[model samples]
Target: MTIYQKVQAVNHLFNQLDKDLGSFQQSTGLGCVANCGLCCLKPDINATALEFLPLAYHLLLNGETEQWLEQLQNNTEDKLCPVLNKVIAPGSKGFCSDYAHRGLICRLFGFSAMLHKNNTPTLVTCKPIKEQKPEAVAKANAHIASKDNYPLISNYYMQLRSIDESLGEELFPIRIAIEKAIYAVLAYYAYRELPSKDDIV
Candidate 1:
């Protein structure tokens, strides 16, 4: 499949995950704090190249791919995601510059689950939710324990790997993943025609 095709597939999965996350949030009344960018501030976040294909494609269309690559390469700090808006304060008012084109890991972070040793799902959330909405967190965990169709991180990742084993299988730091994705898109179009917005759909 072509790079455009891969982006479409990854995006389809992301759309579904968004729906699931909405339902989970609605059901449990658990959510991130308003304007909270704590999660985005984390230095250890990891993602795959395939997940950032949409973002890469977006940058390509905007004629900003090379510019972004240069900026990413120049930034030595691996602590914060480069996609975040630099004008905003780091901890409280952070926001992704490309919110719509954010990767799968960005979409799944606050509202998904991971499997534990005994094969039960644990709601993977941050400290704010645990501290602020303790009861709701408990209810979400119980909902997962009941096995009633909450989103599972492993399942989504497995689906991602199936989309394109090579690009989807490995994890890199957020900026590295974004860089790899930009390169992948650029290389794919180097010897071929760049698709228009309508062509991609």
Candidate 2:
């Protein structure tokens, strides 16, 4: 399939995930924990090259691709994610400046579910939830007991890997992934410019 097709497939999966999350949220009433940027601060958040392409696409569309790439490269520090906006208040409600282009890691972590090797469902959440809503935790445990479902990071990567043997398989630290994502966007547009809707395929 073409790049646009691939992007569309990824987006479709996101839509399915959204429906699932909506149900999960309504059932549990356990929203994202407060002031939670722990995942953001995580030293190692993994993302695939395929997962990053859309982000690059977004940067290209915004006409910020080259400049953003240069800025990311110039910042020798490997720890900070280039797209991470610290000023946006360190909470779950805070969002990435470029939400549309967020990598798989960005899209999956907080809202998604995961499966255990033993085939159990596990929620992708942070410490605050475990602390603030013990009852929610209990309900989640009961939810798991139902063996309903969860977003398994590994499970998703399997499909991603199937798309491009090299792509969805590997994960990079969030910063490097963001850096590469930015570069990819710039490179795509620099070489051929944005495709008209009819030319997207």
Candidate 3:
């Protein structure tokens, strides 16, 4: 498939996941604390290039791909996700600069489940949710166990791989994944026609 096709497929997957997660969140009442972005501050966050394809394509359409590449290259320290707009003031919450184009992990963290070795589904969530919403978390786990409709991390990832196996399978530090996605788009257009205004929107 073409680069744009791959991006569309990924975005479609994201859209469906968003809807499912919304329902899952409504059912469980487990959600992120308002304006909280501590999860984005983690230094070891990893992702796949496929998940960032939409973000890369967005930068490309906005004529900011090179600028983003430079910014990512300059981020040799701290290694936080460059997409994360970190809050500088004490006690303030940060946010994603490009929320609409955030990767799958961003969407999955608090609202999805993973199969444990014993084949039971466990909600893969952060400590804040566990600590603050203990009852909800427990209820959500039970919901996942009893219902097959809850989003499964493995199933979503498998769908991603079906789009483009190469970009979907490997994981890199968040910035690196974004960089690779940018490069993939750049290379795609290098020898082909550029997108028009209507193409990206």
Candidate 4:
């Protein structure tokens, strides 16, 4: 598939995963706190270039890719996500500027499951949820152990790798992933004919 086709396919998968995660949250009564962007503040969050293809493509179409690319290239001090919109005051919760096109790690971090050594699924969650809602966390873990519908971290990641073995499987710091994704899209379009807008249909 072309780069655009791969992006559309991955995005379609992401949309379905989002729906599944929403349903899981509803069933378990576990969710991210309102306006809580603590997860986005993590400095070590890792992602793959392929996961950000849609975001990169969107920026490219909007004529913002080069500016953001420059930012990524030059940004060396801040470990927080470049897309995160932080408050002026220090230690405040922030928001993702590009929520709709966020990467897979962003989508799955708070509401997904990981596989145990014995092959059972374990609900992987955040500290705030565990501390503030211990009962809910326990119940969600039980539900995950018994249910087959919750999104699995390994499963979705494998699905991502299937889209493009090289780019999708290589993990990097989230910012670098974003930069690589932008570079991939830019390089692809630089050498090939740009698709007509309707070609996306």
Candidate 5:
């Protein structure tokens, strides 16, 4: 699929998520706290190449693609997200450097829901919410039980897979995922600029 088409897909999914989260908040009166970056600080969150495509596009548009790739390569062993700002003003949350094109895992980590084995839905949320808002938790759980929530990762991924199986199907470590996504975007433009050649796949 073309890069533009990929971007369109992410936008559509994000809109759907916005609607779903709005409804959920109206019903449950719950949300992730402002300035909480615990999940973002986690060392092991993973993502797919497709999830980072938008970030890649943004990097290219701003002419920072190669620079960011070099940054990632130089920091391969560091678990911190490229977008995270470790040093910030006191009481300020470290922010995503590329919030607009953040990966699916980035988007999904704090606010989304997942399906449970007993045919129920569960909020896949971060720790702060669990501690700070016990009552909201009860209400949100009720909302989840109603089952009219946003499309889960599995569903969105299925749709993405239909567009390009490789993107939808391949999973990688968080660093690797980011690397692949960057390379995917770069290679895409490079390929677009090249003459068409037959590959004996």
Candidate 6:
């Protein structure tokens, strides 16, 4: 399949996962703190190139791919995500500039699960949620144990790899992942005619 096709497929999975996470949040009343960007401030976040394909493709369509590629390449310090904005203070008020096309880690961090040694799923969440809504966190964990519909980190990652073995398998720092994703799209269209926005749909 073409790069564009793979991006769309991966995005479809993300959309489904988003819906599931929203439902889980509504049911259990557990969610990110209002206007909190603490998790976004973490510089160690990792992701795969395939996870950022949609973001790179969006930038390409908007004629911003080269600009972002340059910014990411120069950001060798590997600070916070390039897409993040208003980060005047670490773990303070900020948000992703391109919310719609954020990577898989961005989507799953606050509302997903991690597998334990005994093969049990544990709800992985942030400190604010754990401290402010301890009861909700416990309830959400119980709900996960009783239900099978919540999005799983391992499962979605497996789905990502199924889309493209090479791009999906290699984990990179989030910045490097974004850079690789942009280059992948650019290389795919280096010789071929660029697909129109309508063609993407």
Which predicted model would earn the best TM-score?
A: 3
* List of clashing residue pairs for candidate 6: none
Candidate 3 pairs with clashing backbones: none
RMSD of 2: 3.3
Tens digit per residue, CA lDDT, model 6, 36-147: 8888888888999999999888888878998997787786876778988855457644488878889999999978888898889999999999998898898889988986
Query: Model 6 scores what on Cα lDDT?
Result: 0.87
TM-score of each prediction: 0.93, 0.81, 0.94, 0.91, 0.85, 0.92
RMSD values for the candidates in order, in angstroms, are 2.4, 3.3, 2.2, 3.0, 5.5, 2.8
lDDT of 4 by residue, 102-179 (tens): 999999997999988888888888988888888878878888878757889998999999999989999999999999
User: lDDT for every model?
Assistant: 0.87, 0.65, 0.90, 0.86, 0.70, 0.87
Q: After superposition, how far is residue 157 of candidate 3 from its true place, in Å?
A: 0.5
List clash counts for every candidate, in order. Answer: 0, 5, 0, 0, 1, 0
The TM-score measured for candidate 6 stands at 0.92
List model 5 lDDT by residue over 1-201, tens digit each.
577677667667766766866777777778777777777788787777777766766667667778988988898788877777665667554467656667777766645677779756677776789889878887777766776565365666676566567875787776677778778777878857622222100
Q: lDDT of model 3 at residue 150? A: 95
Query: What are the clashing pairs of model 5?
Result: 83-97
Model 5 regions more than 4 Å off: 89-94, 191-201
Off by over 4 Å in 4: 88-94, 195-201
Worst 10 residues of 3 by lDDT: 85-94
lDDT score of residue 6 within candidate 6: 95
Residue 155 accuracy (lDDT) in model 4: 85
Off by over 4 Å in 2: 89-95, 111-117, 183-193, 196-201
